[model samples]
Structure formats: structure tokens, C-alpha cells
Target: MHLIIMRHGEAGWHTNDQQRELTETGRRDVADVAAHLAESPYRPRAIWCSPLLRAQQTAAIVAEVINCPIEEKSFITPDDDPGLCLDALLEQPPASPLLIVSHMPLVGALATLLVDAHRRGLPFMPGEAVVLDMPVVGPGCADMKTQFLP
Candidate 1:
């Protein structure tokens, strides 16, 4: 199984709440990312996204291109721990590819955790994604496959 972790696109911090929607640039960037995924060999079977507006919007666009159902997971919350989210995802492993649309620290932290279990950190840029191949029998056990940014 392949897990694709993506960070939400650029957002406006001057908005009402942290859940502020994505900017026009953000939308464009996500659209380009979606188009790339649509034409690429890697496609997601299921997509999990944070409830935040920005993250949801990004997932929605990607879903349109990939034609996959989106599952809103609270584990991607800003305050939520990435380790917990990773555990939950591993618990209910998807048969096909899985895409996760989330915020910075969580996305970054998840990538770092997958690459180096001892490292409790997230170092991902916005709109960046990391792909991992994992064994079905042994959950949480993954091998880094590829990483992409758009």
C-alpha cells in the first residue's frame, strides 16, 4: 500500500480563523498538483483530509481529479499529534493508495516519523507530498518510495 501525505496549500492568515480558506494562489497551486496527480501513475484509492477549510478545499480539488472519495479525519487537526494520526491510518489500512491532506507540523511530522522513527519532527513545505510503501501485515512499517512537490 502507498500512503501519500500532502500539506495544505498556501492560506490567508489574515482571515477570520485559522481555518481560513485558501488563497487564489493556493487554489491554483492545488489545481496544478491535482492535474499532475491525474496524469501521473500514482493515484489514490482514498483520500483523508483535515476538517480545516484549507485542507478540505485542497482535498476536494484532488478528489475531483483522482475521482476518489474523501474521508474527513479529525486526527489531522492542528492540535492533534501526527503519531496518533499515523497510528489510526495504519489501523484501517486501505487496499489501494491513500492520500492525506493536512497541515504543516502534522504532515511534516508524519514524514519525518516514517523516514526516521526516532525523530519527532515535521519538515515539509506547503503542497509537498511524500509517498511510502508499507507491508499490509506489519502496520506502521513503511519504506520510502518517492517524494513530490508542486
Candidate 2:
């Protein structure tokens, strides 16, 4: 399976974190990234997104370019556990590549855990995506293929 994990585009501050929306720059950046994916082999067949506004918006942009469907997942919230996210992924049927649009700490930590077998995270800029190739889902079972930086 190919797991494309991404951080949501830049968001404006809101009293409720879930209500924060992407700024204009964020939308443009996400569009650029998605456009790039349209021409790349890493284009996702579907999206797994956080329930937060910014993430949903980001997922929408990518889905527009990739022509894929999006599924909102509660376990991928910023503070959600990477191990649980991994478990959820494992439960998914193997078919097409998946793009996960999520928040900072969770995106980084989950990628780190899958690639390095550690919970420590790799840094990701807004709208950045890391592609991983894994035949099996487990700690240290995946290989980091490349990154899409918008």
C-alpha cells in the first residue's frame, strides 16, 4: 500500500480549533500541490481526512484535482494517537493509494512511526505530503518514497 500523509494547509486562528479555515495562501498552496499530484505517479485514488475544517478544505482541493472521494476520519485529529491511526489504516481494504489530510503533530508522528518505528515526528510544512510504500503495515515496515512540497 502507498500511504500519502499530508499536513493541512495554513489556517487562520479561531477560538475553536476545529472551526479554523484555510487562508487564501493555504488554498492556493494546496491547489498547487494537488495539481502537481495530478501529473505524478503518487496521485491518490481517495482521501482520508481529519474532521477539522482546514483538513476537510485541503482534502477537497486535492480531491478536485485527483478526482477522488474523501472520507472524514475522527482518529486522525491533531492529538489522535499514531498507533490507533495505524490500526485504522490496517483495517482498510487494500486497493488504491490513499491520501491522508491531517494536522501537524499527528501527520508527522504517524509518518515517523510507520517509517522509523518511533513516535518522534518528521517536520512537515503546510500542504506538504510524504509518500510511503509499504507492503505490510507495521512499525518500520514502510519506506519513504518522496515528498510533495507546495
Candidate 3:
């Protein structure tokens, strides 16, 4: 299965919680990424996103272009443990092509763990995404075939 992890677009920091909506540049960047993905050879079966405004908006834009369903999962919430979130996602049934829209540390940490089997966290830039091909064995134990960033 392919797991595509995406970081939300740039968000306004005016709000107290950083739940502010995406800025104009954020929208354009997300659109560019989504458009590129839509024209590419890869396509996701489904999209899952955090409920945060930025994440949700980014997911919506991609979903619109990809014509896929978007499911909100609480595990992607900000400040949530990336390991736990990875565990939860791995426990679920595999989707051939899955897209996960989430925040910085979680997405970065999950990618690091999946690639190296170590929990070293890396910071994913805003609107960046990584596509990983994981073995379909048991959950959280898959081998990585390849990874791409955009």
C-alpha cells in the first residue's frame, strides 16, 4: 500500500491557538501541489485529515481535485503522539492509496519512524508531502519500498 503524508498549508498565527485559516499564499501552494498530484501517475483511494482548519482546508482542496472522499481522524490532532497516531493508522485496514493530511511533528515523526524504524523526528515543511510504499504485512511493521517528497 502507498501512504502519502502531507503537511497542512501555511496558516495565520494571529489566533491564540494557531487554528487560524490558511493564508492566500498557503492556498496557492496547496493548489499547486494538488494540481501536480492530480496530473501525476499516482492517485489516492481516500484522503484522511485532521479537523484543524488548515488541515481540513488543504484536504478539501486536494479532495476536490482528486475526486476522493475525505475522512476526518482525530489521531492527527496537533500535539498528539506521532507513534500513537501511526499505531492507530496501521491498525486499520489498508487502503491501496491513502492520503493523510496532518501537522508538522506528527507527519515528520511518522515518516522518520516508517523509514528508519527509529522515532527521530524531522520537521516537514508546510504543504510538503511524502509518498511511501509500505509492505502489507501486519500493522506498523511494514517495509518501505520508496518515498517521494513534493
RMSD of each: 2.0, 1.0, 2.4
TM-score of each model, in listed order: 0.88, 0.96, 0.87
TM-score of candidate 1 on Cα atoms, chains taken together: 0.88
Better of 1 and 2 by lDDT: 2
Give the lDDT of residue 15 in candidate 2: 52
Q: Worst ten-residue run, lDDT, model 1? A: 134-143
Please, what are the lDDT tens digits per residue for candidate 2 over residues 23-89? 9999999999999888888889989999999999999999998899999989999999999888987
lDDT of 3 by residue, 55-119 (tens): 99999989998999999988887677777766666588646678889997788777777766766
Summarize candidate 1's per-residue lDDT along 65-129 as a digit string, tens digits: 88999999988866677778767866776646788899877776776776666447657667777
Clashes by residue pair, model 1 = 108-122, 109-122
How much lDDT does candidate 1 score?
0.78
Please give the ranking of all candidate structures by lDDT, highest first, separated by commas.
2, 1, 3
Q: What value does the lDDT take at residue 45 in candidate 3?
A: 80
Error of 2 at 102 (Å): 0.3
